[model samples]
Target chain A: MTSVLKLMGMKSMNSKAAKTPLIPYLFWILLFVIAPIALILYYSLLDLNGNFTLANYAKFFTPIYLKMTFSSFWYAFLITLFTLIFAYPTAYLLTKTKHKKLWLMLIIIPSWINLLLKTYAFIGIFGLYGPINALIEVFGFNPKQILFTDFSFVFVAVYIFIPFMIIPIFNSLDKMNPSLVFAARDLGASAWTTFRRVVFPLTIDGVKAGIQVTFIPALSLFMITRLIAGNQVITLGTAIEQQFLVSQNWGMGSTIAVFLIVFMALTMLVTKQNSKGGRA
Target chain B: MRDLLQATVAIVIVCGLLFVAAGQMQSKGSTGSKDTLTVFNWGEFIDTDLIKKFEQETGINVIYETFDSNEAMLTKVQQGGSAYDIAVPSEYTVESMREDNLLIPLDHTLIPNLKNINDDFLNLPFDPNNEFSIPYFWGTVGIVYNPNLIEDHLTFETWDDLWDESLKRKVFLVDGSREVIGMGLNTIGESLNVKDDKVLRQATDKLMTLSPNVKAIIGDEITPLMINNEAAVALTWAGQAADMMAENEELNYAVPEEGSNLFFDNMVIPKTSKNIEGAHKFINFMLDQENAAQNADYVGYSTPNEAAWDIMDPEVIADERFYPSHELREKLEVYENLGLTWLGKYNEYFLEFKMNLN
Candidate 1:
């Protein structure tokens, strides 16, 4: 009886030890992530009149704001899709290469530079007097107005975000079980089938991670959009910025910010659900 | 397998946590340095050489920063806990700052070159007797256009040209409420600082009509837009207009017959500044005739100081964009503060107008 009691006590002590690690985990989540989000939510409810009001949220539902929000998402979606298409081949090649580290560095070195600098570099490459236009003019084409357009904005955004997608896809590809490919091939599956059925499924998490990284930042970015698109194409980010800077309507700005946060959260939830389903 | 999956999740979570911690630490570290003077001014408005010169002369390092709009400058300054030593705010902001007690009064004796500023710019409505601020630069807001692109020999004589249907998606306006709304008000024979709600509404309605023609609403680097031929016309300040004209002779700056708003960006010692003496020294040095001429030449803006103008290059002084005709000067109106009560209304209507643009 004493031995059995001792065994039970040891089991309880082991369980307590196992649970102790959760304290640091909870502390990190609560401190780093939860606090600022809570503050943002709090700030969102306050109105421009210095009174707590739901009017900001009501204002957000107006057709104009809704349209702006829709456009923001649409642009972000296009950026993500383009990034995925561009990144896939590069990621696959990087993973298949023997000198993976060097190739990875080549892919990611641009990201190490300041985002603003990279955007400005594109201005030099794609602006009206930029090299591309100069080259086109030399080829007997009229100088194209490439800068300050929606197309330029998307092009710059995709270029900046491509690495974000590539890195994650490369990571998942790196960790992928090589045997799965061989197993499918041995079963008389073609190379396309092996990739489609085996490699793609295993790397869905990376794709989802890449999408989250690219899409969210693209949505929040006002600088690149403003610089490349020249305020012709207004996004929710720019609108929020205008509310804060030009209007000085902190209440309205906070409201728009909260709405964005909610929309982002909803997207994250959907993606998480999709990721879980993919895992299953 | 479950344990391994849990471990991988744990590692990912830890990495994310570290990233957040590092970001927070870096931000905090960049801030909270007591000796640094965080100055927020208009982009390319100041001579960075002057700041470096000030640091070398006084040994008080300035952490210079810039903003494109007075509203943006105000928003950050209002956040209030940061130690910004000096800010180059426009005339109206100087008024607002004085009323809010956000500015520290200048000790005129400390700024010896206060004598160098033209007497006309000193005793303005924003700060009568130059108590709270020192004038940095002054100019009028007007229209800039490429002569090559305009079909007609359109002299751009009036603000009404902005509303012309032919200019749709070819015109660019400054993304500024005061400038745009003031232009609208002037076109309709109202004061730029109209406090009357009906007059403001009229202006707003008029401006909304011009929205179809507006390709972009921008603040800085408007020169590139005109130079690149992306825009046929732009509403801009004298400095940007002069810069564009310098790059391309086809560009011309014009003040509307309806009149335009005159603005002065002044350097004020903020209440939060620790180095008031250093700030004063910096202001005086900047006001020195040679320094002022260099600044004016570099920024492509007109100087209010006759002494500085005399020292400026004959070519720059002769540039019509920088030096408007006496008749045109007579027609320009300086912006006046509308006080706190009317400011709220101004903000409200501006918000509504911007929302309607969408």
Candidate 2:
């Protein structure tokens, strides 16, 4: 970052040669990010016959799609909420722990395993004959079906999202100036009051970042619903997958995606406050 | 600062060269004079050993590609820039492809062993007189239960039998719109392909009521769950049921006496087939009774080849539960290609039923 600023301050920053480094980044944005989105937008305007039509968008506005979207948002909200609830504490605790980096690495290592493998592991763990049920059996209760329940669905999604939610929060909390905490205590502020005002407000950017990573993926990363919820849940991600893969309705899928992107943009706008103030 | 910029430029240049090199390699693939027969089948659906055998004997390089669903397969075939010598699509998909002129009619002269296919499978409504597709394997959607886990396993004789109050939260339905809704339609004494929205709505309502018995509508995970006695009763394809039954001595499959979907996955030469002769040879090799029997056993699907049955294990051929008799086959309904609108409605109703579950 300092080098970037240093480059900006240099006279060469204004010259054509200085722009060379930005080319690769710009190319990446154009090819991988912008191009695919543009294609999806184009596909959204086409009907089954490849004829130009706004009917897909019109259909998306209907009660069925809207209700699905609402429920998907509700699920994503629950997942994000649960993730934050668990993650904020873990991240804070880790910041105070000895060898915090090692602890953070340990937390992240499980996430490095293939997502499908992790989801598959949960199937065994939550199965009717699985450990949870076995435990229930040992406790003099009848074994219960746990794999397909809403509780399992939300639990697995929250589990998957915790690491993502933690890293950003851990970064921001770790970066906080500790003297402000001491200063707050010196001023006779209660610990709770100090945390609320002095700690949390200063690390709002990290919380926002945490929400950005967890909430957005939670909205779309719904394959776990299929594996864990047993296809009882129809998340927007599942709907999109069904349309594109099962129904072969690219137009409808793209329409849903376009709305998702729009909503995600709105989410970012709402969550992200004035960055200049947030950093301060 | 200069070192960093130079490093970034060098990395970018290397990436650009790599992409160009990859493109060249890709473009070079089409130029090969080597005899390559590309077969697009369901992912892990076929016996890989048979592919190696065909390649070894026929001297044609077997390039196997796969798709998860018929719709996804249809999209690839419809997209049409690339050529696949053979494709295995379900019965309804074959109908759609035939209508869309996506498949080329087979040359019987090259596929001489095609005669081994059972008469029961051929000249069906979908591809009359074996016009485009050869029945690769046929199976029915049925209830498979672990007898040890349930008291009255025989009570699962019909689709309606699944709703028994005794089987509370013990059922796992296959996670497919058609199969689940078809079970609903069949339970109400309607055809699996019932199109009328009114009747469809009835099936949807009926299925929704079975929420008590339905533990989960899961997919391939059903095999592991059922084998380990996780759930007592599961609605699954005969092939998958065979897999579970093979693994667990306690498991048994029954095609509900009332009705069920008899799905056929057939091999067809797509219009874009570059090696038509090679495709025919591959098909003929697979159609050989020994090969067909071997594949049927390995892949856990019912061989449509009648000749293969004589060569198969006597015990297997005797399993009326897995491969039903003529009377049972008559009762088994084959799903038709309900055009986009109706298919979409089927999925919608299924999705609605799913949404109402929570």
Candidate 3:
């Protein structure tokens, strides 16, 4: 192993104590992550004139914007739920099936396309003279309006976010020990009992990770909400876009963005606590 | 020590190249013969061929960028130190830019072709006396409807036609606060920029009545909706109406007699322009008869260049969507810069209208 390390020309480190390799990482985190959040927080607490005030937060908490915030949360929740439902079976089957890597690649291929492109492609599919309407005609039924509807919004959200859920869940499932399931079965547990008691518990980490990946972005989707939802449904994402772009109110936009960050952090905290409790 | 020496050598080489490049750029600037002109305009608003021709004719390099909206362009300029030599902003945005002193006064001596502009197109409220702006393309907000679909209601003579009960679930309103609210105000015979709170509320209430009829609030998507027979009526720009009319003969556009927004998009030099002479040359080249005609033909938007009218297609000239009649022009109101507070109120009403959709 040392020879292989030497062959790669990686100098051998002391076994008892290796040097810290976090300086570059710390620099990047400070610059990109810490600084941007600090800026957003600063902007959120200030008015347009740079006076420190909570007026922006007050505006955000108004009846209309408050409702938009809750609606965004609900949309995210729905998207996460649907994505998980569809992703779990697909991911589980991926682990158990042949050429798992190929299947995983296929699942990830659509996500490699730009999000705006995917949204626009869906726009074509759900358009007035789209294939669905043609299919309806084939079945001798009246065509339905699918584009710009709430269902299409959620549908596109689930489609776009499913891969995010699947990748994390697939990783955890692939890393699971078969012996645990065997042990559960050997202990007079039925197949259902084995999965319920062993498999589900083991995959909890993946589920948490999947929820984080899908829910956070779903909460802040603006383009898809506008394009697919036809701007009929307003989300916090829409509110932020309008505030910054249309109303020219940076304070309100930043306030909503900061609140979204906090909401996401809270979700992460809850999931972290639950995972820790499960491990304990 | 060897690695350090090598790194030092690399830095020295890079520095040498950068210094040479900087010196060359400096010389180019000092000579007052810089070839590059940076232009920022609305996306797909200009004919690319015209830019190429101008580059060839003047032996100048053109660096062009396109913005999707006036707000985005304004924001970029307001961020300070914009590198754009020229930007095309809408009329209302021109007013805002003038108020902020973001634009420089145009040199008429540099642009002799300015005489080609129609009398009607110049000396308006925004940048009056043609001080800071040169008119590029001017259009109006109008209704595009299918004659076959609306056979019974043949005349969509006013903005009130959009509120027709028969058109419920078949109407598409453009997703703009000013155009929508202004149409409502125009229907009620009030000023487009109505300042009174009660009048604004009344217009807002009037708008709410048409909400049930609106199938969707969309921007550019309204064209395809009408083309595909999804919508019988749409409130759209004259440019879109002309484009869609060419596609489907059944489509017709009408600038309501009650009045609508007569918008002008003008080419202006920014205050921070480094290539002011190049900007003037480009503007003059665009105002030339052949160039103006080509631009109008390619973009499908109406041209204000009087000399270009004779060169344009008779079919295009005959289309009222491209050029309104004198009576229709009389009724039209150019958009004014509503102050920030009123703009906020407009946005508030728009949001409220959207919220009530649910």
Candidate 4:
């Protein structure tokens, strides 16, 4: 009986040991995420007239603000799709290579440079009188005006964010067992079938990670769009910046920020649910 | 094990978020005392030599910060946290700041160089009798265009030329609501600070028509666009006009025949200022003839100080862009402060206009 009691005590001690580390994790969430979000929610309910009102949120529903919010989401969605399409193949190829480290270094080098500097570099390369136009002129074509367009905005956005997509996909692809692909092929599956059946399923986690990384940034990217697109293309980021800077409407800015946080939370929830289902 | 890793990742992300929040809170807590003087002004607007001169003349060390726009400068000061010792607000903003009680009344005794200012800049509507602000640099807004880009000798006779189909995707304007809307108002022979809702709407609509032709709405500097020959014509300040013309001889500046907006950037003490003596000394040093001329040369803005104008090279004064003729001056109207109600209306229209540009 004493031995059995001792065994029970040991089991209890082990359980306590497992639970203690979670205290710091819960403490962090309470201190950081929950606190600021609570503050933002409180601030969002304030009115421009300095009274506590729901008018800020009401104002957000106006056609102009609604359009801006929708456009921001739509643009971010397009950027993620394009990033995945281009990055997946590159990342897959990198995983297959003997020189994987070299390829990974090349993918990451651009990210080491400042984002603003990279955006400005693209302006030098693609501006109306830039090298691209100069080259076109050399080829006897009229110089094209590509700068300050939506096309250029997306192009720059994708270029800057491609590595984000690649790193995760590459990580997952690298971790997958090489035997799985070979087994599928040995069962008379073609190369395409082997990839679709064996390889793609394993990389869903990476794809999910890539989407989260690329989408969040693209949603809030202000400077690149502002500098490259010249503020002609409006987003929730610029709108919030304007509220604070130009409008001096802190209440409105806070409201927009609160909405953005909620949208991000909703996206994470959906992503988490989808990932749990183990389906793309 | 999976749960442990998940918790660890969650903890890491939470820590990062906490760090950012803590940093923001710490910065707010550490905003310095009233004894420290913070001077907020435009980029390259003041002479650092003059600031150093002020510090030497008066034992007060001035903390100088800068913004690129009058709107940005006013917004920060209006928010009232990092109260500035002094701010260089443009004429219209002086009116706005005064309306908001953001400015402190100036003691004329502190600025003895008030005698050196051109009579034309004194007794303005923003601060009549120069009670609250002193004129720093004054100039008219107009067009700077490259002659080589156009087939004909294109004279910027009116703001109408900005909308010409021939100049589509070749025209650039300053990305400022007040400047852009003022241009439209000037074209229609209306005051820049028009109070009538009907008149303001007309100006907004007229501006919308030219939106498609606009290649870019640039900020204070258009040197990159003009230097690269990306834009053929730009609505620019006289200082930027002079700088652009200096770079390319083919570039020229002209005051439109319809009218132009006259602006005077003035130095004023904010209500929150601590080191008033240092601010005064800085203003005095800037007003000194040699110092003023040096600053004018550096920033490329036309100086309002008669003493500074006298010291400038004859050719510089003769440059039509730097010094407009009496006839052109007659066509220019000083920007008056639109009261709070009108200014609010202006902000609304401006926001709508910017939003619709997409």
Per DockQ, the best of the predicted structures is 2
**DockQ of all predictions against the true structure, Cα-based:** 0.19, 0.46, 0.34, 0.26
Give the alpha carbon lDDT tens digit for every residue of A164-203 in model 1. Answer: 8999899999998899899989999999988888889888
True-structure lDDT of candidate 1? 0.78
Candidate 2 chain B superposition, TM-score:
0.92
- Cα error, residue A188 of model 3, in Å, equals 3.4
Candidate 1 chain B, poorest ten consecutive residues by summed lDDT:
B26-35
What TM-score, to 2 decimals, does candidate 3 have?
0.90
Query: What's the true lDDT of residue A101 in model 3?
Result: 99
Clashes of each: 0, 0, 0, 1
Q: Write the per-residue lDDT of candidate 3 for residues B255-348, one digit (tens) a residue.
A: 8887778999999998767788999999999999999999988887899999999998887887776688777788788888886667767877
Q: Cα miss at B99, model 2 (Å)? A: 2.0
TM-score for predicted model 4 compared with the true structure: 0.86
Model 3 misplaced stretches (Cα beyond 4 Å): A1-21, A48-51, A273-280, B1-33
* Model 2: per-residue Cα lDDT over A183-261, one tens digit each: 9999999999999888988888888899999888888866888889887677888888888877777888898998888
What is candidate 2's CA lDDT for residue A59?
Answer: 88
Q: After superposing candidate 4, which stretches have Cα over 4 Å from the reference? A: A1-32, A273-278, B1-37, B52-62, B78-83, B325-330, B336-348, B355-358
Better of 1 and 2 by TM-score: 2
Q: Quick one: ranking by DockQ, best first?
A: 2, 3, 4, 1
Interface RMSD of candidate 1? 5.9
Report the C-alpha lDDT of model 4 over A1-280, residue by residue, as the tens digit.
2333454367557778577656665576667856776777787887656689998888889987888888899999999999999999999999878999898999899899998788879878987778899899999999897887778889999998999999989998999889988888889999988877778878888888899898987888888666777667778898787676765666778889988877776676555525453346
lDDT of 3 by residue, A60-79 (tens): 77898888888888989999
**For model 4, which pairs clash?**
B157-B257
RMSD of each: 7.7, 4.5, 6.2, 7.2
User: Residue B155, candidate 2: how far off, in angstroms?
Assistant: 2.3
On a 0 to 100 scale, what is the lDDT of residue A70 in model 3?
84
